[model samples]
Target: MFKNIKNDLPASVVVFFVALPLCLGIALASGAPLFSGLIAGIIGGIVVGGLSGSKIGVSGPAAGLAAIVLTAIGALGGFENFLVAVVLGGIIQLIFGFLKAGIIGYYFPSSVIKGMLTGIGIIIILKQIPHFFGYDPDPEGDWAFFQVDGENTFSEILNTVNNISPGATLVAVMGLSILLLWDKVLSKKGKIFQLIQGPLVAVAVGIIFFVLTQNSSYLSISSDHLVSVPIPEDTASFFGQFSLPNFAAITNPDVWVTAFTIALVASLETLLCVEATDKLDPEKNVTPTNRELLAQGTGNIISGLIGGLPITQVIVRSSANIQSGGKSKLSTIFHGFLLLVSVILIPKLLNMIPLSVLAAILFIVGYKLAKPALFVQMYKLGWKQFVPFAVTVFGIIFTDLLVGICLGLVVGVFIILLKSYQNSHFLHMEDVSNGKHKIKMTLAEEVTFFNKGAILKELDSLPRDTYLEINLLKTRYLDPDIIEILDNFSVKAKERNIDIQLLSKRGVIENPSSFTEFFRTRPKSKLSLS
Candidate 1:
């Protein structure tokens, strides 16, 4: 980790820039105190990042949990009460880790995972569009399709058209231009360019523009449109922001319910993010999921103790770290330190940076995650893979992250069932003799109820006066429903003047009196293939 400090330090700065607005915005959206988000960010970075097995994945106050936090805070009656739930949720997550439930992350299909990254990318792009144009109704980091402000994503974009701020638009365009130039041209020139990334330069340009245009009414960006970190008047007031959890709420059943909810949701979101981050990791390092859960649980416990919203491994910050060339966990830890120091020391300077600049940086991140080429690639994999991927993307866009993933999982499972049904058995026509067909049916390795319909269809469609051989010699296990199907089919075969040959490990039976009876009564006997 120390060996990559050169790469990690600059990357941490980029992640810190990305995390700052998000921390504040998520807190604003969650209806929690603004400082709470920062505390979570600080803890997520330093504590969770220290304990986590992931080298690249970063943790923070997640936008995914904002809605849950908002609801829980209200239901629990206050932020202090909500803190109790957060602490308990951490304990539950620790239990989850100890139980080794991290294997749950492996169960998510690759298509859905890709779709999630793409979906989140698209969400970031869509959500940032308004902020790019200086529309400030929604906070900087609110990524939900339906916002707490009563407007949806697209509606905000549309409203931004009418309420566009010339200053913001100018700054955004300049910010984007500077970023593009830095990425494409300037950054390749020398070590200096590489040391100073595109996002940092874009931010510098945004601040300079803000200062220069202060007197120009049309070009001056409003305070609301700028990055707003809570300014503490003094050290005491700053420390005053921290609140203690209400231990009295621990006895409340509703607190336990909320804690369980947070644990379940935060754990799930963290797992999903871990998957996404590993996919994004250039080195392809695999993070220990169980350890990540333990790390997150610990972080959440500390965060709750100090009046912060729940924390999760966040894809946005993680992706930023990767995109900005973060090589190890040091970047994650350094970013947390930056979050801590910046708030303590240079928050006033941070407040000068415009939101449009950050939006510009995120636009690039979003584009990389949901590149148009990825869609084409997924489509080429065929509908079996594409459908779930597409559904997950659309679901996340129209609904939310977890809902979209569930929808994708459903589609993925449906595809699996369809394939299983089709592959359950194979039919081969041997020859035609005396106007009669000899058909051999081979059962798959494992036959389940899903395969019953396909097998039944084939049995029912067989021509009359044919000799049918039912081969079960290769099948390791068969569902009883399939055995019942064969039993019923034998009766129908006799009516159709079809002769039946049943071959199994129990030997051959020609015109067996009863299929079920033969299987039940016959002892295992090896039959020669010859």
Candidate 2:
């Protein structure tokens, strides 16, 4: 890790700049103390990053969990009581890690996951627009469609247009232009551009702009529009900001319920982020899922003990780290230290940076995540993949992350069922001769109750004096409902004067006495077509 310090140090600085405002923003969104988000960021980087098996994944307070945290805090009666739930949630996550439950991450469909990334990207872009324009009242990290401040996403943007800050607008435009140039032009020119990331340059320019325009009437950026890290007057005040969890709340039934909710949601969010970060890793390093859970659980435990929000593997920060050239966990660990040192030694300096500048940085991040090319790519994959992907994106944009993913999963499942129903069997009608029809039906490798309707339709349409052959040559598993459908179909066949032949791996049964009996009588060994 030390050998790569040259690479890791620069990457860590970029992540620190990226993470600073977000830490405060997520806290603001969660309705928790602004300092708590920084606490979580510090622990997530130092503790979780140190222990996690992932080389590139970054952990921190997640926007996805802000809604849950907000409700949990309110329901638990107080912030201290909510801290109890966070600690218990950490314990539950540790148990989950021990149980090897991280495999659940693998179950999410690629379409849903891609949709999630794209959805979050679009949300980031939309939510940042207001901040970019110097409308600072709504808070930074609140990306939900319906904000905690009672305004929706579009309303916030509209409101920003009405109350635009000239100073902030100028800073934001300059910051964005500098970032775009650094990324598109300067960064490619030499190693210096690579070493000093665009975000850092943009932030520096923002601070300089803030200082220079302090006395200007129209161009002055208000303190409200700047990055607001809790500045401690002294060591005592800094330490005083930390709150202890109320252990007595542990016995409360409501606390347990909240704990379980946090554990479940945080675990899920972490697993999803792990998968996403792995995808984003240029090295393609596969993170050990169970180990990641354990690391996150430990981080949450520590964070809660010191008045912090719940921690999870955050995709935004992780993606930012990856994009900034983070190559190892050292980058993650170093970012944590940066968070710690910045809050301690440079809190006032950090407060000087404009929120609009940070918004510009995230704009680039969001754009990368939800590139138009990706949408077109998904569309080209066909409706089966695209519908779920589109639904997930729309759901996330309109609702929240978890809801969007669930909606996408439902769409994805429906597509699977539709395909299964369509592919259950192939009906080939042979030439009709002498007032008789010959039809051959080949069953799919697996036939379920979903296929019954299509099969029944074909059987019902059979003409009188027809010769029908039902082939199960490739079938490996047949549902009982389908078997019953075929059994009932035989009676209809008899009424139509159709001669039925059932062919299986065992042998051909001509005019079977009972379709159910034929299948029941056959040994289990004969069921395999192989």
Q: What is the C-alpha lDDT of each candidate?
A: 0.92, 0.90
Residue 299 CA displacement from its true place in model 2, Å: 1.5
TM-score of 2: 0.96
Model 2's alpha-carbon lDDT is 0.90
Residue-wise C-alpha lDDT for candidate 1, range 158-201, written one tens digit per residue: 89889889988888999899888888898789988878788888
**Winner by lDDT:** 1
TM-score of 1: 0.96
- Considering only N, C-alpha and C atoms within 3 Å, which residue pairs clash in candidate 1? none
Query: In model 1, how large is the Cα lDDT of residue 363?
Result: 96
Number of backbone collisions per candidate: 0, 0
